[model samples]
Target chain A: MDLATVTARLLKLATKVSDEVGSIISNPELDARMDRVPANLGPYGVDPFGFDPEYLKKCMGMVSWIYHNYFRCQVFGVANVPEGRCLLVGNHSGQLPFDAAMVSTAVFLEREPPRFVRSMIERFVPDTPFISTFMARCGQILGTPENCRRVLSNGDAILVFPEGVGGLNKTWRDRYRLQEFGQGFMRLAIETASPIVPVAVIGAEEQAPTFINAKFIGKLFGVPAFPITPTNPLLPVVGLLPYPTRYRIYFGKPLQFTGDANDEDEVILKKVDEVKATMQAMIDDGLAAREHVFW
Target chain B: MRILITGIAGRLGRRVANRLRRNHEVIGIDRRPCPALPTDIVHHRVDIRRRPAEDVFRHAKIDAVIHLGIIHNFRIPAEQLHARNVMGTETLLKYVSKYNVKKLVLLSSGDVYGASAENSQFIDEDVPLMASQRFPEIRALVAVDRMVQSFFWRHHDIETVILRPTFIVGPNVRNAPSKYFRLRVIPTLMGFDPMVQLLHEDDLLRMLDASLKPGLRGVFNLAGTAPVPLSRILKILGKPTIPVPAPIARALLERAWKYRLTSFPAPELDHIRYNTVLDTSRAKEVLGIEPERSLYEILEPFRAEDQADYTD
Candidate 1:
């Protein structure tokens, strides 16, 4: 081989080695030391490292890369995110679940110690090997009521897309529209007496325009989409990459539901609708105020 | 009679305006200016949520309002949908009742049928309005219907006609089944034989003509008699059909719902998946008018346009 070709092959080998090392270092067991909390902070009742701050910082860095490089996100109204145990509800966009990453990064950057968001994980994530381990250690759990209540009671900020899977799965044609939200979050908040903060994230939809979803293949593949999306699913090795687009996180004022905790279902549903309306309005206003649809 | 048509620029609104123009002295009210209508059809530019109802209503000797302006998508934000569809309707109803308008015609969609499996094949005016578990727009419309029903029953001498339409197919639908059909790619079965109900915009106007007839009041399902498959409609357009696996299709739909791809599936995909069909016999019986165009006929105008130019 020529001198240049040999040099290029050596560089490729070096990159592969470094990637493997990085992957090994990111393993949950290797980073178990990050979970250690300092003894001096016991009086404050805050276990700073209880969540593995180093791993969190690394995750935050990854999130920053995704937001800045991939989504080019510009977040605002993060100051409206309450200090503790508040339910953060925002408008979800795109088929892939990147809004959670953006919101998590925003909270991490805004808050001093960076409050961890209790997120809902897909069934597939936990079933996977490496990703499952990292996600579990990083603090994302199933969005069932039991977990939501547990997370809220323990004074952790919970982020939920009340519209659930429907909101994120919206097509390119229905961009910026808030789908019907379920009453679970409202019920959880009322049951736990936690405040609900409405957040509006504008400009995530333009990054990836999903016009049509072919469902039959998605079921066979055990994922939402098997062949479509910006990243080809058949090429699973590189399927996780998201298309870059501008993102803005707009946080609205917190809405506290002080009605009877044991209120009837009708009342709770009404309150849930009200909260959804508030969040929808914030999203509309945010989009309207923007000079361009995409940043 | 002095009438206010909110979406005067729309297909149904223009038809309603055209039908009511000479006899009723109609005053058209729209968010955008319409150059097609005659000058006598009074036009006003105001957002129902942001503009005062009195200011819009006080312009003439307003007798009734045809509320058609709304952001019609299930994936739309609850607040915006509420503000435009629910609050705007509420504001219009409140102002019209306050002004002692004789009647109001509120345009509602058959999507109020939340879950298809729970609903009977034929939904009538008396069918119970159930809240949708998936779509927020339907919930908002349900709220609008409740508000209108309560206000008309208790508050004033005002008469209200709630028209629930099923899959309105025409030239001016701006989006949806129209956009999908224009692209020659509507999700359908292998045989293209899923039953569908549609009403031509012109026939819908004729129904509006009947709605304005003396002493007409009550809810009616305005749709066509026969059901047509989406495949047949695409065949009429002569567009190539691509078969997608159902599971992958649903996942893609869910993804589209997340990203706001197509407006039709976001809030109503579950219902569509279950083949939600509406009974429009009440419209035929009460309105005494049959829609002129069939599903195939509705696709004619766009069929004439080059397929390449129909990009959404």
Candidate 2:
């Protein structure tokens, strides 16, 4: 055989060696999971997205650190969350969704029985690298009305940011301004009879104050936006560190709307507007109540 | 009841025959002679397509016919497989209907569902058969499945119970996934982590036993274990997962498959990237049979074989 063919064969063999060693060291507790958990599944259950209790436990540990230490996140009115299926309508912000993470972390760690919030991510998320499977395994579904319906039907709480990309990619000037919410969540709540829990996340606005929305960068990299923060352009490495703002998450009372999913746009937008107004009012209240951006 | 089981020499077929032999009479038929069967159970060495299956049907009144003759090996040529699976099944189905057999059980694969991103979380029986779209070779099996279903609908008297089971692995069974898993290193498509389920040998045998019971008819997805991601399965087994980029991996697999050097073909790579998690609630509720072992418990039984190879 030629040298090239021989090199290819040798390279393949080397990859196997590295993978064996890499996973063993990287995931030191993998062997421990095998010993601790009953193999595969048990008589009573299984989460459809290949959700692993062990992996979720590991992730919760890190998210709790960020919630309590980094963000200093304080959740209020969490009792408003219904026992069964409900739509969590929150304002999406801070470029990175530290908002969703904090809300889910609150439910997971703080609540009794500990719930895992099924966050509906943007459509483009699954198209990214290692993130797709990671998100699925974490019980995050693609942000589609069909997927949302399915999750609610299963009686799981779902987090929906109706502003979609428009909310998360807003510049510093529009930080506190609520965008036009997507009408899908309102329709979902109506269709599945899932109560809507409007949430307002304060202090996330100052986290990564974005000044530039480079559409060119979004096109080049296939991202929602190529955002530029003060620290981001000035200090390349440390720029990613959002200012440790003291976050206050307020979960409002459940709002139930009765209507058909096949209702007119005007009909759906009215309900969507009501949810938006409630969230805006909460944001106003939280903003007034906050002592400082970082304490 | 006197029953006839095709491909009876195959691991699963033999197990099915052994189970049935305990209570009922069995006639095992295969193209290859099987020396391992019990003397009490009669064996016929004949290809269903070439020979008239009526010869066996005429010998004794066959109450139930279990067709397990579909060749699942990927190395076989497409034309030969079509002849063996499609034509052979057509001939057998005709004989079963003609011989006035009360029931016909056709063992099939879950791969018939076809793995894709578009599928819902847990696919029930109503989902379209999309497996043939990606891998045309699976068309023969799909055809058989459709034929069985049509026969079920067309004739009310002959009870046709079609089972589409997922990757079944145990000590004795051999298939694409098990063969790939047995190796020290397993290659997977990069950036894809499809959920997969496993059925135990006992679970499968039990399912076959359930089909024979009165009032069990219709299409059923026979699966017992909860679905697990491909990476976790490899990790649990202590086997290395070499995630090759999809394009390069596809080309390499096609070449490797052509040489008969690989256990899985290029098309099977699509499976590692996407998933088909069958909802087996019907199998549980209606059949009154639940898989005794969880997906992990079934996998646990195979650790000894995997560990022995790794140690060597």
Top candidate, metric DockQ: 2
Cα deviation in Å at residue B114, candidate 1? 2.9
lDDT of candidate 2 over A239-293, digit per residue (tens): 8678999889899999999978889999898888888888999999988888888
Which window of 10 residues has the lowest lDDT sum in candidate 2 chain A?
Answer: A37-46
List, in order, the clash count of every candidate structure. 44, 2
TM-score of chain B of 2: 0.94
lDDT of 2 by residue, B1-312 (tens): 899999998888888999999999999889988986888999988889766566998879999989998998757888888889989899998898888999999998788888766666677776778888988878888888888888899989988899888888886777877776777677777777877888888999998899888767888898867777777677667766688887898898899988887777788877777766788888888888878876556666545453644321
Fnat for candidate 2 (0 to 1)? 0.29
Q: For model 1, state the Cα shift of residue B40 in Å.
A: 1.3
Each prediction's Cα lDDT score? 0.67, 0.80
Stretches of candidate 1 exceeding 4 Å from the true structure: A1-295, B35-37, B50-52, B73-76, B189-193, B257-265, B302-312
Write one digit per residue (lDDT tens) for candidate 1, span A1-295.
8999999999999999887556444645323423432121211122221133444545654555566666776777677777768999878877777888788767765544445576777655533434643564455655556557756776778788888777777777788888888888887888788988888888777655665666777788676653355555545756545556677888788888877766787888889889888877888887788887555
